[model samples]
Target: MREPVDARRTRILAVVHARGAVKVSALASELEVSMVTLRRDVEELARTGMLRRGHGVVRPMGDTGPTTVPAARGDEPVGEGAAVGLVVPERHSYLYETLHGARTALEEAGARITLHIAPQMAGAERPQVERALAAGVHGLLIAPRWRSAAGEEADYGWLAEVGVPTVMMERRPRPGSVLHAMDTVCSDHWYGIHLAVDHLISLGHRRLVLAARNDSPTARSIRAAFAEIAAARPEVEEWSVVLSSPNAGPGEPGTLEEAPDLTAHLRERGVTGAVLHGDEDALMLVQRLTENGIGVPRDCSVVAYDDVVAALASTSLTAVAPPRAEIGRAAAELLLYRLGRPTGTTGPVRRTELLPRLEVRGSTRALLRPAD
Candidate 1:
């Protein structure tokens, strides 16, 4: 006969509490059992509201007392008496600006911010959230590192159950899920892409191409938006979208240098204009096109996202300018609202979506010739 489920659950909870956290497989091995048996035990304990399991490990039972989430940031150092935890995913300047804006806003409002960065999972956010809760932080402003909204609620719900208010920055809804409740701030990607497409179409670009990364939610949105816009333009008949690996190094089999294939694809489809997802890649794409004796804006027009340091660094790039400082300030303010320092009201559940402006530069010109 199988061991009683209640006894197994109690043993699992006890082990999780005593060990701080335990993997399901570890529990199985330690108890001289199979993985399936341990999983059933963990599931029963979870249903009873004893411990929380995510990814692979089981987190401790919730503290019934009121909880505070400390702001943790990777850009700043950890200190004693820091009541808020700010979790910055990685140390990029753009990300830093967002966090800095949040920090400045919070400080002006007399809130303490402890910034923590996790290079990967183990190095930062997971441990920081745990410690902040243990140290008495009542709320958390987590700039989640998820690429998509799917499966995010399970990770974040744990924070809510423990009585911590969380604000996700730069994230939008997944296909069948809604992660937006407290507040979410993201670039107006669909509208931005609309501007890009319209600019190309107006410039006589009947054959257009989009070069974008296929993995990110932002990239996926851009593609979907592109398709929506294209379907409306019957005059624009021949267009092709070439997906490229965003981080593939130069000269690799799948690298952006595959621009030759991209250009070939464009030529075959009679493409005369291109929309780039990132400015860095946009500049490179233009340079490659020019090297192939193609005159940008003269023979082909282009537009890209983010006219920041990358766009400015390029000699010429017609790009979308995300309101960087404003986005930073808005994220900070929303977080403060969650922290109870209401700046402006979008009612109780604060939500704001910011639009991006198109910056027309030297890269795009009116298309004079028809696709041949």
Candidate 2:
């Protein structure tokens, strides 16, 4: 049963006047009202000049007392009580850091976060998003598991009309598509791949091989970027792409299994340099190479794609480290700006990209010259 509007506002104003200031979450809980209902009441009261709504806190107009709430993140205030939904694929350590970054930023800005992890399967994100929407989230941050263009397009129509501020993390929509107009923040993977390939070429490596997964959007992008980079470079003598794992088929990304060891193949093909996607695959392949009497940086140079565990490898694998956390922070900040927009004004869509860096380690070295 809905409480009478006058009664609710009377109680709300009483609490604010008594406490001098209160967080939106605490106020809503005290009033035993839904956030949606509380937001409507607050908006109404603010319009009638009864209260002030800013910095995600409600306070009486003349009240200047200190708030019990902790200091917020940035100097600027995001609207109080804003809750956002975070959806990511399961078991993605790379994205887990992204989630943490977003959580920190939102919590610092005085916003609430509702997290939902999509299971590793096709069409898992929609239901989770529906749940968030039903619960009245003000915004969303999603890293959809897109294995192919078709897979991504299937979600575009519905996602574009989610009716709230949304920022995609580490995912890019197709050019001119409906989602292309949506806000997004992703690391420049092409630039990351280029950094790895260029690093290898500068070390006098001509023959290169890339063993990478073909399961997710990042994996597909890395594969294509490697092919384009290797083909475009006249310095590259031979390059090839092989499955890093045979577990996930090209069409489905549920099972990520390791591919057969390629130690003998690398020897037969005279490949002196290799780039491996993901930290685990690189570590495992390097172990296999060592078992076959091939020493890293001596017989074969390796560059791992993800840096999550690359630094922990026995050889301390050199890696292209994407700005995983920044992607989330940027996305969250953008969404907050959208949420706090002055009424009757909508902002332009934004697509932001952060650069990745090369972490040089013991895994790569300059090739031995004949003179030496």
Residue lDDT tens for model 2, 1-372: 867999999999999889888888668878898666887899899999998877568889997654345533343333565778999989989999998889877876668789999987777899999999999887899999876666788999899889877899999888889999999999899999999999999999999999998877888889899999999999999998888766533554444445656797788888889999888888888998899999998989999998999999878999999999888888988887787665435568899999999999999999887786
TM-score list, all predictions: 0.66, 0.79
Question: Candidate 2: TM-score?
Answer: 0.79
Backbone clash tally (model 2): 1
Candidate 2 backbone collisions, by pair: 56-80
List residue ranges in candidate 2 displaced over 4 A: 1-55, 58-78, 248-261
Error of 2 at 40 (Å): 29
| Model 1 global lDDT (CA atoms, 0 to 1) | 0.64
Which candidate tops lDDT? Answer: 2
